[model samples]
Target: MLELDGTTMCKPGPLNPSIRAHSSTLTNKRSRRIKGCGALWGEIDHAQGVPAMLLISIQTLLRGALMVGGVSVVLAFSPLPVAAQERMPMRIAVEGAFPPFNYLDANNKLQGFDIDIANALCETGKFECQFIIEKWDDMIPDLIAEKYDAIISSMSMSLERRQKVAFTEKYYNSPSVFIARKDSPITDVSPAALNGKKLGVTSSTAQESYANHFYPDMKKTVFRSSPELYKGLSDGRVDIILEDKLAIYDWIANTKAGTCCAFKGPDLVDVTFFGEGAGIAVRLDDKERLARLNEALKTIKEDGTYDMINAKYFPFSIQ
Candidate 1:
């Protein structure tokens, strides 16, 4: 007759998914027998009487075995165990340099609409999140390399970018505008009106691509950063600036250099140049991660979280 922990081990009954077992105070005298029959037919050695920790592995292995009905199963499990997996935090990436969307405050802490949106998503999705800062140009490449998870930077969703990384639904769409000195007479956005004028745009962005494609005749001056472009504009180094309208709005309202510039003409939003809108980007192969972010984004928008963040940043809807 088969014996287990001094009890006759009969044919094992149907295994319960939630299996538990208890053991007496362990000693070096002999290996201990598990009370549960689900662990198949093995004696677990309780090292230094630490049944508390070994029992957990015993239960997990038993449970995992029960999943396959008495078959010895070899499986890799997370070091966190089942409960800890639920509390694991997600890693998110952001440029951390784009203000109004995402930037460091006076105290050098991350705070802005983009950060708020990321927090809201984490709340709605019931997951913890940690934001990481990456350079504007390396957002996509680093994402693919798995340096971080999702990107919440104010990255425009363009065809060229879509080819590299997957993007969630657009969070907001702001039109592009041309800004020049208030005294300047360039009122038209047409290439004919501003052909010979020097135009400044951020390097490697949709704005630069737009100017290069449409206004090829215009002297295109690419700056490495927004501040540099604005400096060029303020010092009369560039005759015009074309970029996101909301960014331009923030500049004009708060910065001294922006005071010298005003909107030149109507908003420009060609899909060919701008793609769709700004969106959160993720790794191309991470479909489930993408789905979770989309679900979180939808929940926030439906529950007014998005509106609250928007109002805190802009007076009008940028959506």
Candidate 2:
């Protein structure tokens, strides 16, 4: 007989034939069973001549022991269920210079839409997530080097990036646009119209790719961060800047320093330049983690959590 929980006792013997037959029926319908302990315990209660309480106590004991490094002993009986295993904490990388999406506040703490969305995904997935500040250019290399498990910065899912990492379905989509001084003469925003004009773009971004691909003859000034890119336009270091339309709108409509600039021409979008939209990126090999993030993203969107976060950041939906 095996003693469990210092109270329940059951002999090691085959279950009664009738009980075994009944349990088999339950096992066959496992997929339709209601989730959680109650449904399982209720089914056990109906097994005739079997000590259901003893089995429950034993399961509880094994679970407690496994938590304290008894894996080998538990494996002797059966492998632990995937759901029973503790999940490793995830480290997420974010660029702390992009405002409204992600940025460092006055106290140097990370804040903004990206941070909030990352937190919501982690919460929904029951993951312990830690955010690491990384340079926009270094995010992918750092993730590949295992410095972080994922990059939650507003990274576009461009083809070049897809080759290096896997991206979850885009959390939000926004178009790219050009921004120039309100009084600037360059209105057409074409390569020919702006011949010899200096263009500002953040290095390693899709905007830079677009500028290089479309305006090879135009002079280009690359910046390392969004704030620097905007400053280049405001301080007259560059004649014009191209960036995400929503981000440009956030700066122009919300900040006093952005008073000098306004959108130029039409929204610029190309499947080759911006593959889809902003997505959370994980290492190419981390498929399990990527799937979890994608599921959590779907859950948050369905449960209205995503809408709350979106509304807090923007007046209209960016999805």
Number of colliding residue pairs in each model: 0, 0
Clashes of 2: 0
* lDDT of the candidates, in the order given: 0.69, 0.72
Question: For residues 164-231, could you state the per-residue lDDT of candidate 2 as single tens digits?
Answer: 99999999999999999998998899899988999999989999999999998889999877888998
- Write the residue-wise lDDT of candidate 1 on 44-123 in tens digits: 22223334677687676767544467676677654432222232245566655566787656544566777778766655
Alpha-carbon lDDT of model 1: 0.69
Model 1 residue 79 CA deviation (Å) reads: 23
What's the CA error at residue 304 for candidate 1, in Å? 1.3
* Each prediction's TM-score versus the true structure: 0.72, 0.74
Top lDDT: which candidate number? 2
Candidate 1 Cα deviation (angstroms), residue 6: 73
